[model samples]
Target: MRDPVLKHRARGMRMVPTDAERHLWQYLRNGQLGGWRFRRQHPIPPYILDFVCLEVCLAVEVDGGQHADSGYDEARTAFLKSRGWRVLRFWNNDVLRNPEGVAASVLEALGGVRRADTCPHPDPPPLGGGGN
Candidate 1:
């Protein structure tokens, strides 16, 4: 039962993640979202998430035309909620038009985890070279 439902959704999700999903995926795919690694098209309990950060119990869904089926989407969300996952949905247009805002929203939803700094630190001198 669960397998079929998941498989069905997986197929639909794969048809082509909307432009927004792709845009968001750029940040999420490489741990760019709040420095936490996120998986795209991840399979959770009874559903496949558009993006998920397992450590934070967060799932981001990029909704497209088919999402007009509110009834089914609601049921899916309810199931995910029951499993302790927080789901965030964004329309495809929203993402495409505001990728930065979308990324900010995702980061905000992640409780503001710190991102790594890019500057390199100077190496300490060898122990022998240091004065005792």
Candidate 2:
């Protein structure tokens, strides 16, 4: 179960996204990036992801100078990875100055592959294969 406080915090963050976050969101929202849907300010326990495609288990984070060389980020990434998520981090300047490039990198990581471990549903049985 998710903490209610964290869920509320994530909702509040969505209401006041930073410039870089807003910029990246344009590229990520509505399945604009290679048909992958991304949710901003999504709560995933212990942390709120800046953006996440839950279907593919991909997390995209945009950071400012304050996050440079931060140990907290390293541990956070490890935790997400342990939960079967693949995290991609970008600097605010990079996203603001070259939004296209940042988006391209994210698309490349998506690569049209959905990991079974991360997919929400198991593969369904083939039609007409299973006996009644």
Among the numbered candidates, top lDDT falls to: 2
TM-score of each: 0.71, 0.86
The TM-score leader among the candidates is 2
Q: Report the lDDT tens digits of candidate 1 across residue range 1-132.
A: 136677667777767876777788887777776568887776664567788777767789989888886898999888777766678998888888898898889888877543433212112345566565
**C-alpha lDDT score of every prediction, in listed order:** 0.74, 0.88
Candidate 2 lDDT, tens digit per residue, 23-108?
Answer: 99999999999888899998887799999988888899999999989999999999888867889999999999999999999999
Model 2 spans with C-alpha error above 4 angstroms: 115-132
TM-score (C-alpha) between model 2 and the true structure: 0.86
Q: Which stretches of candidate 1 lie over 4 Å from their true place?
A: 1-16, 112-132
